[model samples]
Target chain A: MSEAIKDLLKKNHMSVTDSRLQILDMFYHAPGALAHADIEKKASDKIDRVTIYRTLQTFEEKGIIHTIPTADNSVKYALCKDQCAEGHHHDNHVHFVCDKCSKTICLDDVHVPEVKLPKGFQPHQSNMVVNGFCSDCRS
Target chain B: MSEAIKDLLKKNHMSVTDSRLQILDMFYHAPGALAHADIEKKASDKIDRVTIYRTLQTFEEKGIIHTIPTADNSVKYALCKDQCAEGHHHDNHVHFVCDKCSKTICLDDVHVPEVKLPKGFQPHQSNMVVNGFCSDCRS
Candidate 1:
């Protein structure tokens, strides 16, 4: 896993650092999207908040991760697929937020359906978020 | 307009105050959703940031306005329709974020289409946001 992380950072032209490696590892193991607080808690005071924030920003800029917006204004970050690259993202899938467990999962297989806008409206991209009970919580 | 604002506040069981009235007025006249910075700027230093924050919270809790989540994690607020009441929001319409002008408009008539989740997922509510050029910017 650490070897893969090193290669990813090298491919993105970012230096291999402990903070970046730890953060990326957490995303790899996360069941769903992770918020800033989650990363902070998982670091167990080893990494400062500023470092985590900066690492997340750098990762996002390099397209290593994507952000998921929530209704309550708390943004969550998740690992991006191999399609994503620097300054370009192809994450067009729908995001699902489990109401029971409050976990946000990327439904990569389910694409966002196109909506018919009023005349004179030109669409570029669309994002859809569905609140529901995930498979784990359903049972 | 002031009388209408007062009545709306009264209906929500909130006392009419300068800060609340001013913030509510901003939402009424806004062309699109207003963010925290927008509200603060429109207040012209008459209202403090804390007051503006509290007023927005009160209005949201009362269902006077609904929040639209943006990709940048900055939540925008817009006035709710008459159908919305305290603790209930019927703003299921699609939100349009204009990539050209950076305006987030509520397409009241464009409802969010139902999405088919995978098996074992039970949906409760869905929110859709489309990014594009609005009618004014299309030309």
Candidate 2:
């Protein structure tokens, strides 16, 4: 895991700093996406809140992570698939937020369908967020 | 426009207050979804910023309007189609945001596709946001 993390930073030309590695580690083990608060908790005082936010922004801009919107309008970050590049992100999968657990997971298997827009609306990218109960939360 | 605005407020059980009326009027004439800043500017200092935010929240709760997430992570609100009720919003249509103009328009003709999630993940509601250049901006 550590070696892979180092390689990711190298690939993105980002330094293998402690904060970056720690945050990346969190994503590596995370079952789904994570919000800023979630990362802060996982960090456990190791990193400040502002630094975490900046790290998240940097990761997002580099396509290392993508943001998912919650029902309450909060943003969450999920690791991108291998296909994501610096300027482009192929995170077309469904972002499933567990209603019970409030955990957001990226369903990589389910790709967002290609929708035909009316004339004159050229589509660059699309996102789909599904709210539901996850496996653990299911009764 | 005044009568239509009054009827909308009445239908939603919202009091016909000046701020509510002004905000509703803005939506009625807006070409696309209006961001908080956009609405505030149009309010022309007649409405306080806090009051505008509350009014927006109320309108969203009543399903009078639905929020759209932009690529830049800003939230914009657009008038819900007539199908939206107090507690339910039939905003199943695709939300197309023009990258050039930064304007978001609800494409009522294009409904969000039904996606099949992996087992153990039950879906309740979903939102699709498409980023692109609108017709006017394409030229």
RMSD of each: 2.0, 1.8
Pairs of colliding residues, candidate 2:
none
Residue runs of model 1 more than 4 Å from their true location after superposition: none
lDDT of 2 by residue, B37-80 (tens): 99888886479999989999999889989888555568889988
Q: Tens-digit lDDT track for model 1 on A49-78?
A: 999899999899899999997776788998
Q: Give the Å error, residue A121, model 1.
A: 2.1
Query: What are the DockQ scores of the candidates, in order?
Result: 0.77, 0.70
Instruction: Name the TM-score of candidate 2.
Output: 0.93
Give me the displacement of residue A19 in model 1, in angstroms: 2.3
TM-score of chain A for the candidates in order shown: 0.95, 0.92
User: Residue A11 error for model 2, in Å?
Assistant: 3.0
